[model samples]
Target: MIRFEGIHKSYPVHGREVVALHPLDLTIQAGEVFGIVGHSGAGKSTLLRLINGLETPSGGTLTVDGQALGTLDGDGLRRLRRRVGMIFQHFNLLSARTVLDNIAFPLRLAGVSKAQARARAQDLLVRVGLEAHRDKYPAQLSGGQKQRVGVARALATEPKILLCDEATSALDPQTTASVLQLLDGINRELGLTIVLITHEMDVVRRVCDRVAVLDAGHLVESGPVAEVFLHPQHPTTRRFVAESEAIDEGALQEDIAHVAGRLLRLTFTGEDTWQPLLGRVARETGIDYTILAGRIDRIKRLPYGQLTLAVTGAQSDEALRRFAQAGVHVEELSR
Candidate 1:
């Protein structure tokens, strides 16, 4: 339940104004896991800060749940911020505070009674699977555990929306997966709306329901994760998806040329089935197929498949046309 219309934010740099966010307009619905992705200096972080009033916009309107954030003063914004929680990459916990106390800190700020806060903290510790480590300090906990404490603390206030600023970036791959799973669980169970910003497409692929691509302070693309992954429009979006696929374009091209065959890359989504298409192509067309690389995975709980094939036959064009007629995308690689 957030809307940003014609939002702009700029700063003075080297005696000239630099735009960090260039009049972006976006809407995030309630109970949705939305992702903002881009490289560094893409203003993704800046956009998140604007939502929480950490950075005021230079022009235009920002509304949260129908309330205009731009009109709110310091005290009003403070009150509104309680309904929004944020988690950081570095697991920003007070090192001196124990795990339980760290979670309790937010409740304390909100003037939650000690006994009530303790009960809430205990429940959160248990929720995050950190009940046994409640007495341990931040330094004693592992990176994942520390981040769990951060999550517990962020949830302490029972915020409706959670802002994750590269929450999994600092963790190892295994730990990152664990943390992402936790976020997914929270969103499903609590119906909490989560807005996550990260450079990793894998993270978005695993957890995000919808994603928005930002580049040069502009909103380039936004849609369901599966749709965006299957048909990326922007250059940056295509690059991210290609990199995530780990496609070796140069090598694939060389192999295709040397083999004196056409290289076709096909993507299959939920509506289309890959096995039937592969079978039909083999049975109908006399072309022999060499599958160089391929993968099938889930995005937002939907099947997404990709295949790279080298076809050797005089009827290669016919085979490609068959695939296209069957609604499969066929991209031919250059030599």
Candidate 2:
């Protein structure tokens, strides 16, 4: 578990001070996968670094699993880091070491005997499905393989917390999916609290339980991933969600400019998504419907639907009322 109270960070630039992170208050529950998303220079990396004491906060305090980060001394910080492992976007492995040795490196640094380290590394290799590549060097393995080694190494310590800094950003889509699956498995099996930083909302949708959005070092939004993804409130959060769905609200409005009737955006979640709400409402009200833009999909394990429609006929208002009665979220785009 981690908690941030009025935590802020800044750096001196010439005679002036530049803030990288505004005072932020956040909580990351134990055994939950929490994600931080923002654009470049948004201080996402800075926030991640602060968790591990890599960057000292300029003000306020950070409490990680009951340890106050600001109170830790050099040795205390080092000990804390050993219990909080981190993986990088760029696989930072020793090129001279083989995959087996690369994974064993952290264990060895932690004072494990070479034999014990190698044995632990061997187990991690199989866990990550990279046992067959253990004898290969960093250069000899594929991008995915190298990241697996990085993941294996990060898990070598069996830390209570795992920090993923764009862990899948460098991989292709397929590879990214596979790596994300691996992270999810680790979270489920080990109950490791994961804090990952990424610009991709898709990553958050697939793996994170909760997410926080940042803009210019300011915390814009934070909540359960489904709530934030489904009904984004902040401008930055809305932009991220819209971009992830590849639907521009302005463009959608323009496209439906000539369409008749009230334009409504209906959102359905869980079993509400599966019910024949649309057909039932249409038939009951004799409202003719024209589908515009929409999608039926799952967010994490929960099914959801978002439909933009043109509803007409004399009973159109009644159709809208029926949609709400069926537990559908309706937004009047045009009426």
Q: Kindly list the per-residue Cα lDDT of model 1 for residues 1-335, writing each as its tens digit.
A: 89999999998899999999898789999999999999999999999999899998999999986789978888999888898999999998998888998899989988999999999999999999999998999889899998988899999999999999999999999999899999999999999999999998888999999999999899999998987887788999988887878878677666676665777778877768446788778778888888888889888577878887878888888888888888887887655
- Best-fitting candidate, scored by lDDT: 2
TM-score, candidate 2, is: 0.97
lDDT of each: 0.89, 0.93
> 1-99, model 2: which lDDT tens digit per residue?
999999999999998999999999999999999999999999999999999999999999899989999889999998999989899999999999999
Off by over 4 Å in 1: 271-276, 312-327, 330-335
| Candidate 1 global CA lDDT score | 0.89
